[model samples]
Target: MSSNQQSDNVLSLRGISKTFGAVAALTDIDLDVAAGQVVAIVGDNGAGKSTLVKILSGVHPPDSGKIVFDSKTVEIPTPAAAHRLGIATVFQDLALCENLNVIQNLFLGQELRPLRLNDVAMETRSWDLLRQLSAKIPSVRVPVASLSGGQRQTVAIARSLLGDPKVIILDEPTAALGVAQTAEVLNLVERLRERGLGVIMISHNMADVKAVADTVAVLRLGRNNGVFDVNDVSPEDIIAAITGATDNAVSQRQARRKEGLSS
Candidate 1:
């Protein structure tokens, strides 16, 4: 985590540690995300990035930690609990039904049926949500299979908003998109922040992180390597933290010299 902390964070985690029997997945991690902010979690493979996401999503309870949401410390023990606390997650596999239309997919599990199926209301809401994000979907009546990769991602993200969540966790949202598609999704992320929602994006794409993230948090070998303001740090330094490239003898010598100069 960074040495500085935000005074009005919507979500704050402290000393969060988790283990998987013999392997220590995460150790003493700290993170803060404020409303209208996009925090990107970047790490190399097996660097405990996914583990930390699971803990936050309530797929796995942390072995030790404190989780504060809206300035209140609370325990998230299940996915339902996380949802109840206004936390929503969109995993890499969008979980959308290709055979169903946009509206069908959006209200699949939680349909807005008072007496019978309210198709009109559901379809209208689907369009409203997509319009809010400025999504480029062709029609809300078309099957999801007919949509492009970016459109499918937009649908999944829009579905996560059904409950009016305050925080949204997106895992590799643009991992499989083309250049144009990636830009479309990134624009949606910006809109989410504009709506005052806290966004946590887990991605390996440094370019994407640097493009949209307000803060970039780097994890190295199950520990908090560093958290940087995206504008203040260079891509080279962020990559160094991800690969431990800055820990060599030459880098250490340079660090010592820089410290001596500062002293």
Candidate 2:
């Protein structure tokens, strides 16, 4: 969430707090995702990154506060309802079945059926989506297991876009990929932004964050620390925010510096 992102917040989360029994997974989180921007959320282990995504994906509900999607504050209680509102989440696994063909995997649960399953229409629609996204997979009929990791990932993302989602949240997209595959995934993310869809990328790799993110948002200990334009801050500064080792990141490091002086 950059300063530029502050101007046109497509998604606004105000004081969103969530708890589980005695465990406070998130507290007082405020974030904004503007149109056509990819915001990366970086943090360490137990930083509550997964929990935050669950909240956005309708796996968990906030105990307090509000979430505004497309200017209207709303509550997302179920995955299907979230899909209806155009929020899609791609998990770490990419979630594609190896035995299935590209088109079969793409339209798995939501197969298009007129009187019966419309195989021709479904495959044609898949082809159209691949073309629209400019994805590089060669054949839609090939088994997913036969394709490279990057191509399989492309299928996962293409499936997400079928609903014309307003925002897409990607969880550790390149965590297990090789250097080449990582680059490919980053390029795909760039295409997502070019298509005007808001992107929330969760990664442990700052390198990946710096590569494709328009904005960087830090979550330390299940709380929003700060959000900044990628060009406005350094990687070290972002790390400081992630560890809460520096002063106040939300207030632009001034609060932390002033506190240091007073102390």
Candidate 3:
């Protein structure tokens, strides 16, 4: 995947720090998500992955840092503020209404209520959004509960695309999915990049990272270790970074395997 030099980046974070009750959730975190790129963040259980994304989604604020979007530094005080800045996050829960159909769920919070919703107009617009984003969801009439895991992810993603956001954050998009479903979701992520949207994905699956991510950013404990091009780093190297041994060279288990091979 090629990095877009001409395409302006949509996000910049410098010296980001966050804490909770004297425990540091993040420290000195610096990140960049350029428009038209897919950045996958991976880490171990306590790697502060959630904290970093929460800051991006406006669920939490950085104790000290700067958030710059589209050449302007801005404070994201709330989710609504982030929305106004064209930053949309599709969280793990998806927050869909179980009884509502796809069309209804997509327009849930931003419903066109005053003039009776004009179902035709909404569906038409929804169709356009999904088509523009190249989302793989086949139908828009089924309840969100009735959709498959991949389709549900597609809907959640589609909902976020309604406002043509510059930055889209997705949390663990394929966490509980089967192989085929995971493939479907990753394909949708690629589609997002094709549409010129800056995508930041938090995922545990390295295979998905290798498959869909252009750049992989590793967060170790509470600080960002580095960002490397997916093609330039091996999964084993990423594992080491996430496991907090990025520069030690030979991890113990790898040494043991090497010694065994020689024996």
Candidate 4:
């Protein structure tokens, strides 16, 4: 939506809304993600970030909205459908099997050959995927549990790429990671963008958003609050949008100070 043509957007949502019993989780939300761009969705708790992610990931269908993918209106009825449509979501928990090695986890259910169990082929493809992201794993045969937080994230993201998805949704990708690990994940995000994949990064960390996202989309009380180019917008403005404090006491005080200085 930030000057990107509709044709360039790999995923777009219009009039997206969702309700749970009597609670309206989302209302009239609109978003756009162009290919090879990183758009960060930031909001306070209960601001409907999770609901919107679920809707796009096909966990829950929007009550009324149009989802345009590849310039075609489409309905993502299930997670599988979302994947089939080139939409991949990596949730915060990651869902990686700690007991399984990186290679085992990558091809858990989608191995190369069910009958033959092509370990060599799967390992080769896994290495190829990891190399594409410049992952820092010592060995693919090691248990994922032995990997660092950032390494695990790299494995999960690499697995998501196996399907050749056009759009990848990352939910709080740097959460619980150390500063070094966070930087590593952010670098991987840049690699994803370089690969020409649309990236929707949901995070509460303003620093992370500003560090990697091209645009920031704010959600307030389940509605579109504001969207801004990361380079053109300040972190304070983004936080103000998330907290719904754009015209609040602090801003009024700042405005008065500016007026007095100008006078």
Ranking by TM-score: 4, 1, 3, 2
Among all candidates shown, the one with the greatest lDDT: 4
**Once model 4 is optimally superposed onto the true structure by TM-score, how far is the C-alpha of residue 128 displaced, in angstroms?**
0.7
The sequence of per-residue lDDT tens digits that candidate 1 reaches over residues 94-169 is 9999999999998988998756999989988888999999999888999999999999999999999998998999
- Please give the TM-score that candidate 4 achieves against the real structure: 0.93
Against the hidden true structure, what lDDT does model 4 obtain? Answer: 0.94
TM-score of each: 0.91, 0.89, 0.90, 0.93
Worst 10 residues of 1 by lDDT: 1-10
Worst 10 residues of 4 by lDDT: 1-10
| Each prediction's RMSD to truth | 4.9, 5.8, 3.2, 2.7
State the displacement of the C-alpha of residue 203, model 4, in Å, after optimal TM-score superposition. Answer: 0.5
Each model's lDDT: 0.92, 0.88, 0.87, 0.94
lDDT comparing candidate 3 with the true structure: 0.87
Query: Per the 3 Å backbone cut-off, how many clashing residue pairs does candidate 2 have?
Result: 1
- Model 4: residues with Cα > 4 Å off, grouped in runs: 1-4, 247-263
Model 4 residue 213 CA deviation (Å) reads: 0.4
Select the stronger candidate by TM-score from 2 and 4. 4
